[model samples]
Target: MSPTNPSLSPERVRADVAELLGCDPAEIGSDDDLVDLGLDSVRMMTLVERWRAQGATTLEFPDLAERPELGHWTALLTGSAA
Candidate 1:
């Protein structure tokens, strides 16, 4: 599902991350652990870079990796984090 604000869908975000990491988008689950998926610091940075390319100005990898859930990341993307 996408955010209520509808800037982008969780699937789209997952696809973008998968493309940046050179993996299959289907492999990333809403609750999967990114660190367990081999998303090291470098990979996290790569994710941030990709996010920037997609127009996210305030996202940081550490924040996303801390939770690594589609819901959490989607909230961040939508600036719903408080």
Candidate 2:
């Protein structure tokens, strides 16, 4: 199943990231750097593919990797980012 919800919340993003990292959702801070948390290129690409398949087609691995933070990703996914 897709990690993102239809509402596209930051919490969902955090949960997805936590799952990928084999951690808890609470462990993933909204502003935490995923790369610093062991999020490598392969995992990042996997997330991109999964999210894209769930309709986040504009999501790019580079974009996510550039700033691997749940808050920013949530904003991008929900069209709330500047």
Candidate 3:
């Protein structure tokens, strides 16, 4: 697998999210709701743990679940400490 969005880049987040959803990166709009694209609580938590391991310590499952959009997560994850 390719590297994930450890740096929290918007594009990288979108790509990673797309991969997690088993879709093409182009299919994920910046504001598209991830849950609508099939993201469940387990998957959301998995993503949170992966990102946290990659240094996105501030990322929380609830935050991502509340706003499952690339742009929103990008903004949130970008502020996280390594």
Best by TM-score: 2
Model 1: how far residue 22 lies from native, Å:
4.0
For model 3, residues 10-34, the per-residue Cα lDDT tens digits are 6666667878899988887767788
Instruction: Point out where model 3 deviates above 4 Å.
Output: 1-6, 79-82
Q: Per-residue lDDT of 27-56 in model 1, one digit per residue for the tens? A: 777677766776677867776777667667
> How high is the lDDT of residue 19 in model 2?
91
TM-score of each: 0.66, 0.79, 0.79
TM-score of 2: 0.79
Q: Answer with 2 or 3, whichever has the higher TM-score.
A: 2
Candidates in order have lDDT scores of 0.66, 0.73, 0.73
Candidate 2 per-residue C-alpha lDDT over 41-69 given as tens digits, one digit per residue, 9 for 90 to 100 = 99889878877877776677777877888
Q: Model 3 lDDT vs. the true structure? A: 0.73
Model 1 clashing residue pairs (backbone) = none
lDDT of 3 at 42: 88
Name the TM-score of candidate 1: 0.66
